[model samples]
Target chain A: MGREMDQEPSVRTDQQLIEDVRNGDRSSYSELVKRHQKGLLRLSMRFMKDLDLSQDIVQEAFIKAYEKLNLFEGRSSFKSWLFQIAVNVARNKLRENRYHFSDIDDVEIGVNATAESSLIDHAVGNILQKEVDQLPFKQKTALVLRVYEDLSFAEIAEIMQCPYDTAKANYRHALLKLKEVFQTRADLHTWAPETNGMFNEMNAKFAEAAE
Target chain B: MTQKRFYADVLLKQTLKKEDRVRIPTDESFYEAMNNKIMMAIESSEVAPGNKWEKPWVFLEPGIELNEGAGNLRSRLSSKSK
Candidate 1:
C-alpha cells in the first residue's frame, strides 16, 4: 500500500534518501516526504488541532528541511531532526495564535455535559482527543511522541530540546494528569475492555502508590 | 489501595486506549496537494542551487557560465589588466 512496501529488500534508508536529495535528486526529496508526511502530519495535529494548519506545518517543515538540507550534519537520525523542525514550526504557529501552556492547573478540559454526551453518543475517541488537547503542551507532545509516534525518549528529548529525564517526566506527568481527571468520571470504565491489559497494570500501580 | 485511586487509574488507561484508536482521516488529495506545493517551491528556487532561496548571482553576460576556477581566473586577470 506504500512505496516502502514495493521497495526492495535493499531499499535505501532515510539517511540514504537524504543524501540523494542533497546531491540534487529532487525525486528523493519526494520519497523522504512520503516516508514522513503521515506521522509528521499527526504530530502537527497534536499541536494545532486543525487539519489544514497541520498540513501547512508539514509542508513548511519539508520545504524548510529541503532548503536547509546542507545544514543537516546527521547529529541525530533524520526522523528526529525532522521532528525537531516540525516542533519548532508548531511552536511558532502556537505563538502566533497567542497560545501558551502556562501550568498544569491552567489546563482546562473541553468536555462539558453537552460535549461528553455528544461524544458518548457518537465516538469515545473524540472525547479522549479533547482531553488530550487539554493537556499542557509539553506533556501532550511527550505523550503523543511516545504513544503515537512510538519514538524513544532520546528522540523526544532531541525534538523537544530538553533533557531525556525531562521528556520522561513530561510523559509521566501527562498520564498522571489525565488519570486525575478521569478519577471522577465513571463513564470512561465502559471503554475499559478496549485497553486490554492496561487497566490491570494501572490498578497495580495505583495499589503500589497507595502502599 | 483506595478504591477511588484504582478507578482513576483504570479510567486513564481506557482514555489512552481510546486516544490510540483515534485516527484523523486524510485522503490522497491532501498528499497530492502537498506534493505539488513542495515541488513548486523547490522549482522556484532552482536558481539558488542547493534548493536554498537566495538572490541569484548577477552575471555580466546572460550566457556566461560561472565555472569556479575560470571565473576566479577571469576576475583576477581583469583586475591585473585594469
Candidate 2:
C-alpha cells in the first residue's frame, strides 16, 4: 500500500487530476502542483525577472487556480488556463511595482572585445535585456510567450486574451523593434557572419514598412 | 502554413537563450521548498461560505515572509473566482 501510494502520479492526465480534486481529493491537487510548478515558475520568471517574486507568482497562480477549480469549464487546456492566471498575477505585480531597468548607455563595449569574451557576451546580454524591458507590455508579453515559452500564436492569444492576429502582430512588432535597436550597434557586427544578412533583410523589411 | 522567417528572430532567440541560461535557476530544492510553502498556504486557509473555494491570500506585501507563510490569507475569492 505504501509503495502504491509512493508511485508517481504523472501517469494520470491533468484533467483526471482536476476531476479528483473536484471530488474532494486534495492530494491530487499536490500532484497537479508538482506537474505544472516548474513550467509556471519559468513563465512567471519571464515576467517578474526576480526568482523570489516569480516563485510567489507561481504559488499564487496555483492557489488561485485551485480555489477557482470549480469555474474551469475546460474550454482551453488546463495549462493554458493556469498560465493565464499567472500572467495576470505577474502583470498586476508589475503595475504595482513599476520595474526599472538600467540605461543601455551604461553597457560599455571595449574596442578589442570579441564575441568569445564573456565580457562582450555579458554586455550584449545586458543590452538585449534593456531593449526587451523597454518594449510595450503587450509586445513584450507576446514575444516572451512566443520566443521563450515556444507557445503557438493560438495559445499566446488565449493567454494574452487577445485575438490571434493581434498576438502574432505583437510578436512581429517586437522582433522588428529589437532588430531596429540591434542595427544601431556597430559592435555587434563581429558577432556572426549571419549578422550582415540579417541587417540586409531587416533593412528591406523596414523599407517595405515605410512604403 | 509556412511561416515567414525573420532574420532578426534567429539572433534574438540566440541572445535570449544564452541570457536565460544564466537567469533561470534549475535547483530542485528551491522548487521543492516553494511547493511546500504553497501547499502549506492552501492547507491553512479557510474555505469560504457556501463555496468550496478557500479565500485567496495576498502574497506580496511587506513583512510577508516567503518560507514562514505569515501573509494574511484574506478572502479575495469573491466574484473573481470566475
Candidate 3:
C-alpha cells in the first residue's frame, strides 16, 4: 500500500512525457499514443465516417506525430498539435477519396428499435448527420471541432490554419445551415420542450447575424 | 470570445453523443491492438531508411486490417522497403 501510494504521485503530464520521449525514453511515446488515440479516432470518424478508414487515419497521425516530434515547438498544447496533425491527415484522405462520406444506408443504428421514441430519435439523428455531412468541409470542420470536440475557437483556428474570426464564422455558418432544417421540419420542433428557449435564442442570433 | 448558445447546437451535441455511444469502441483489447499497431509502425519506419518513412500511410493501405499483429506489419514494411 505504501509503494502504491508513492506511485500515485508520479503521474506525469503530457509535456513531461514528451520531454522523456525526446530524451530517448521510447516507452513515453506509447503513453502519448494511448492518451490521445480515442480522441484522434473520433475526430477522424467525423471526417471519414468509416471506422476502418478513421482508424487508419488515426494510426498515420500518431506515426507522423512521432516522426515530427522535434518540430512540435510548444506553440500549442500537445493535444492540439496532435489533433492538428490528424486533421491534416484526415483532410488529405478526404481529398484523395474525393470527399466521400459514408452512404446513409451504411450507418449502424446501435440502439434497440422496439421503442417508438428510440426510432424517432434514430430518424432525427440521421437527418442531423446527413445535414452535417453535406456542409462544406471548412464549415463541417468548424462545427465538429466546436460542438463535438468542445475545442476553443482559438484551437480550432490553429488546427484550421485560419484566422480566429474565420473559424467562428465557419461554425456560425454551419449552425445557420443546420437551423434551416429545423425550421422546415415541424417534427424537429417537438424534439424536446426544454429546447424551445434555445430555439428562440438561435433565431434572435440569426436575425442579428443577418443585420 | 464567448460562443453563443443555441438549441441546434445542443441538439447536435446530444445526437452525436448518442451516435458515439454506439460507434466508438470501448473494448480494452481494441485499444491494446491499436497501440501495438502504432508502435510497430513507428519501429518499422525507424528500421527502414527512405522517403517512405515520411509517408506512413504507405503501410496503411485502404481496407487493410490493422489489428494483424506487429510481426505481420514488420514483414509488410520490410517488403515495401525492398
Candidate 4:
C-alpha cells in the first residue's frame, strides 16, 4: 500500500524534469541521471559488452546531455533523445575497439531473477547477448534499438541513419539469428522467452523517480 | 536475454528512488567548473581556423623533410655497416 503511494510523483513528466533542470535545480539533474542511467547503461552494453567501458560511455553521455539540455526541442521523446546520445557514444567506443568488439546488449532473456534457475539461465543469456553483439555494426544497432529502445523500424531508421526497409530487414535478420542461436543451445531450453509488459514496469518506476 | 528486461526493470526502479529527503547540496564548485569549461572552449574556438599552421608534431607522416631524412639515416647506417 505504501509502495504505490510513494511511487506517485517520482516518475513525474519528462518535461517537468527538464524544466526543473533548466532552472538550475541540480537535484533534477541528479533525478534525471538516476532515473535513466540503467537504461543508458544497458543500451551502451549493447555496443560494448565490457561493463566498465559501458559505464564510461554512459557517464560521458549524461554529461553531454546536461550540457546540451537547452538545445532539446522536444520533437522526440526524451528516451529517444537520450538514447540517441548514448547510442552515439557507444558507436564511437565500438569504432575505437574495432578489433576486439563483442556484443553486451544483455537483454533479460526472461529468467526469474530470484529463481535458482535464474543463474543458469542468465549465464546462457549472457552468452547469447555476446553473440548478438558480434553482428555487423548496423545490424546490432538495429536490433538493440528495436528490442531495447522499443522503437519501430521507422524510428530505428532515423536513429541508424538507414532506410526504413533496411532497418526492418535488419531487425528481422537479427531476431532470426537469435532464434537460431537459442535453438542450437543445448541449455535445456529452445528459445528466448517473452518479457511481457516490461516497459510498463519501467514506466511505473520512472514515474516514481520524480523528485 | 529476457532476464535482461527484468534486470533493467529492477534497476530502473532502483534508480528512480530518492535516497534521502532534502539531500541537496549548498555549494559552488559545480557552477564554477561548468563556467570554466565553457570559457575555455570558447577561448579555443575564437582562434580562426587555418589562420596559422598547426605545430609540426601534429603531422601524421612527420614532415616530408623528416621522412626524407629518415630514409637518408637508414641508407647512411646501412652503407657505414657495409
True contacts kept of each: 0.17, 0.18, 0.15, 0.02
Better of 1 and 2 by TM-score: 2
lDDT (CA) for every model shown? 0.66, 0.69, 0.70, 0.54
lDDT of 1 by residue, A1-211 (tens): 6777877534676767777877778887777787778878878877876778888899889888888777665545567678888988998898788654233344444557766544443444545566687887789888877766756666677678787778889988988776654444455555445445444455556656657
The candidate 4 chain B region of ten consecutive residues with least summed lDDT is B55-64
Off by over 4 Å in 4: A1-11, A99-127, A161-163, A179-211, B1-82
Error of 1 at A2 (Å): 23
Pairs clashing within candidate 3:
none
Tens digits of per-residue lDDT for model 4, A87-124: 88887876777637433343445456566455554455
Instruction: For candidate 2, write residues A87-124 as lDDT tens digits.
Output: 99998999999976557687666656354466655666
Q: Write the per-residue lDDT of candidate 2 for residues B23-57, one digit (tens) a residue.
A: 56678887778878888888864332234353322
| Quality class of the docking in candidate 1, CAPRI style | incorrect
Give the runs in model 2 whose Cα sits over 4 Å from its true position.
A1-8, A106-116, A190-211, B1-11, B19-22, B45-82
Supply candidate 3's per-residue lDDT for B79. 44
* Candidate 3: tens digits of C-alpha lDDT, residues A92-151: 888888865555577665545466567656666677788888998899898888777876
Write candidate 4's Cα lDDT for B4-73 as tens digits.
5445444432322211111222344633443444333433322222223331111111112221311222
* Tens-digit lDDT string for candidate 1 (B1-82): 4676656544565546555643555787877777778777777553224434542222122122222211222333344366
